[model samples]
Target: MMLNANLWWHDVDVVRRPPLEGDTDADIVIVGAGYTGLWTAYYLRKLDPTRNVLVVEAGHAGWGASGRNGGWCSAELPVGIGTLASKYGRSQALAMRQAGREAVNEIGRVIAEEDIECGWRKDGTIWLARNEPQRARLMAKLAEEREYDIGEGPTPVDPADLAVPGLLAAAHTPHCAALHPAKLAVGLAGAAVRHGVRIVEETRALEVRPGMVLTDRGQITARVVVQATEAYSGLLPGQIRRVLPLTSRVIATEPIPDALWRHIGWPGRATMSDQSLMFPYLQRTSDNRLVIGGRSIGYRYGAVPRTNHRDDERAWEVLEREIPTMFPALADIPISHRWSGVLGVHRDWQPRVTYDLATGLASAGGYVGDGVALSNLAGRTLAALITGTDSPANRLCWVGPPGRRWEPEPLPYLAIQAITALTALVDTRESRTGGSTGLAARLMGIAGK
Candidate 1:
């Protein structure tokens, strides 16, 4: 199997849309036709059919992280609820949580209304704790959620029922769903078109100016310009330090037989992950294949973003080893695919949706690795702000002025490397000692806040 080929694109044949010809004009010109841009375009047209919305893409729609992610349409935010409360306020934090849960349902509703068969399932998520240290962390998290009176926070599940080996404890949250990411991206693009939004594929957006977007094909003048180029934001001029691009890799196994599934039971098909600092996330695909991903390849020097990382042998090796360790029943299963994608991470690790009415500029991203569900919310908020629609989404915590830009090059590169190394070290130490690493708490404070 090709390491760079996305598993989700295995059976889907994608036809590129016509690129923009010469100069053009639109009510909204959005750069990068990933989830954020496409959703924004979809909502813009839905909210006001008269508005001319144009989305220019470097490649086919969803070619970025949107199509290549872990297939988790989860309500999990890049920052935790407690983190949000401390930074904003308790009510605002709760609202953000509610928005996330609502976003999950909103996506499902859109998928159904569009009749897009993308293997959508609302089976929820299960987070396992394989060691005592990890269990402690999960317990503490549950305690915090209860203290805040968060709605139906994760509840404990018996490890024996999950069938995963060495699971000391498990917590399941009903706020997530697993689906084919590429299918959703392609579906959204089709939906946007049906809603009268113009999308130009294979047209690279060179730069986003105040009221215009300069592309490789030509210039597009618009009343409002949006930069929706998540991880690739660093590649744009004047946005080199805006968001650090962190690489995460994935490996998918061949379909597991029914007999093997009995030994590794996840009949609910819920997305699963462990509580380790540098853990892996897994999901049972609609086709019965087990897809596991994580073990970040860290950030590249100069914050450069690329489509392929064929040199990520170490990360791939780690993931390959992880599958068998987690589910011994899959020890003989062959990994059918391997791929990597970059996700945007803000300095404070909080995603944002910002619109500046003065410059007619709007942006949304920095989702870390949680863009699937959050992007939908961001798109609605962006549309509301652009179309002057009175929506509560416009008041979410993520809708505001952009946060601080990441520190210049070498600094961010070094910091990411240090953090990655510390994460691995903490997990390894905890696994060996079966005790909490006091440093884990401090590391979370630094990495998250």
Candidate 2:
């Protein structure tokens, strides 16, 4: 049922498969079968078919964020412009942005070649603006994005119409795209199998201790172990520092009629809500429903939220009232469903492509919410590193885990939820009063400019 509601990208032939049994040994073993691992396996096979690759999942493939989350196939940097310039410098940032731009195209190519039925829409996206401060900030983003060598530039809604306008600004780029993330995940799994990559589901990897992964059903002893669990990265290569878990959410509006679509003017458009730190994002599916996301909260000073469904429901309510506010016609519309997932966030919001110099283990995450595009780059980075290719990718430095530099915070679930609710309360007020900024925005880094 949870799976069915997220149907825009599902395929009948790609239903969840059975789990693995008995001991297994392969040349390489992968943990977590979400987008990252699936693509890793797929591309690895593309690199070599007879390498004896084995992949194990805690649940069905795509069951995590892969199956039940927003399908925004974006290539833009989710990290703020200021951070990108500060860390990687302009040239490397440009390459990172270019990788994002190229990812959607690569995703499309793989889908087409495999004949996967996931709804793949290459239409551009819009960064819907909601408030005055947001609009002002967006104006700055538009200019700054132009400065960056983004494959495409942002289109502003200068003096945007908020009451009737979907957003104060609609940042569109051919580089960012959308698709049924679930189907793509499943398709990749199936493709991996076709390429001689064995996949195992319903198996939890309890421990990773040098060449052996202890699973509930059995143990996997392999030569190489790759930790593909991005958001839930830890337990392997050690949890990244400053790379805390952020709970983001998504919800689908009842199938919007084509007439409403005419009013929205985004049959081919998607939107990212504006926030210096974390904010909401929305887009039209291949079908006519609006899939909204980006309503998120930082991990309890340290721990990840276990009940993102509840958080997502709360986020859905925020969108329910606000999405209608964006377009009056959408006011009375019903919401079809909602779900949530966590992302790996570095302090600065850049992804980590960390390869432990001490250990043979290699892992990457900290994409913040930009993993869709950046992970592809990480895959290439990983392949290059493994095969000992001397491409420029070898020099890339990922956000190392913040364990030694930072200590974990003890998060009491209820208090953390309250903090999130408080943020939304302030946001609701700002959204209603035209727009907002200043202290609150700065706290989140919206004063990003």
Candidate 3:
């Protein structure tokens, strides 16, 4: 029973493969056929044409966030530039930022060269500040970028120019691209298969040990075993504490008329987000619909939610409330779809990609909510690590160690509840006073760093 949540399905064609039936062995086996796993396999075959690679998935390919994201293939990393600088000198931080920018362009290039019909657009992204606290945060971010000598960082835009109501200010960057996520995922999967990568769907991995992966039907043995399961990693043994799975929900409105779009005046199709703790991201789809998503949806215990369901009524209410506040022009527009998906969040909130050659095991995940472009970088870097090739991505600061495990049961539950309550309180205060009651936001920033 697949969830009927993803709007990208309208344009994608899916081919489901049979599950792993008997004991299988390959040179390398990848668990989880999402973007990370598919891209890794694609690069692996590209690098070594003869290396035997097999990808096994619990569901069909692109069943995870790879197929169900906000579709902003933006050049954003979960780790901040300032944090990277403070950890590993300014030069290394700048190099990492450059690598990220290159990765963004690389995605666009891949889509074009492969001729994936994902509605690729590179109008860039706009960060709108609708209130005083948001403006301060944007200014602080600009100052940090300037300090790091980031020439292509966000540039300020006056509210008068944007014409968005309640827009204190806005920033623009040309690095982010928009595309249909499912199209890219499906296309990549097809490319990997065409490149001689074997893919087995409906094979649930129960445990991932060094050089061996235990599954519901049988076991797979390989020289290298790569765990690409992001949020669903908790289902495997000894992996629950590694990440906290948080739900992110999205809603799309019916196609709006050209007249309504002109009245709104945002024809650039730039991926847009506001300065909120529960950051809301909006996009103008190629078909003239508006898709909005946020992370205020509730979380499930032990990082496992109902797998076959997509309904999140509370999340729908949140988006419904926010739509009127942000874009009054679409107040009466009917919602066409509503869905939710979970993403992995490290305890420290930084994304990680780790490979251990000694154990013949590597895992790449914990992208927080920014896996769109980061997953591409992770796939390429993981390939380099497995093949012992030295690429700039392999040398990135995020490549060495895995994330620290989360705290025990009661702690994660209590902390998340408290944090959600605090976030709501802070949002209310900021909205009411239009002032700097940004303690919650500041704490979250500090924790992620």
Q: Which ten-residue region of model 3 has the weakest summed lDDT?
A: 302-311
As a whole number from 0 to 100, the lDDT of residue 61 in candidate 1 is: 93
Tens digits of per-residue lDDT, candidate 2, 1-449, equal 23314554433444566677878788778888887777777777777676777888987888766675667778766666556667668776676666677777888888899887677877766665566766666677777777884545765544243335535455655666777777777787888888888898888888765577778879988766777776666443345344556677677876788877776554455544564234667777777777877655645444552444554566667766657666777887777766667776554445666555445466666666667766666776765665555656556445344323234444334444665665666676676676564556545552123
Cα lDDT tens digits, model 1, 139-161, are 88788779766667777788998
What TM-score does prediction 3 earn?
Answer: 0.95
Note the residue pairs that clash in candidate 1. Answer: none
Off by over 4 Å in 1: 1-4, 307-311
Candidate 2 off by > 4 Å: 1-14, 156-167, 235-243, 272-278, 298-305, 308-312, 397-406, 411-426, 446-449
In TM-score terms, which candidate is top? Answer: 1
Question: Number of clashing residue pairs in every model?
Answer: 0, 8, 0
What are the lDDT figures for the candidates, one per model?
Answer: 0.87, 0.66, 0.83
What's each prediction's TM-score?
A: 0.97, 0.87, 0.95
Among these predictions, the greatest lDDT belongs to: 1
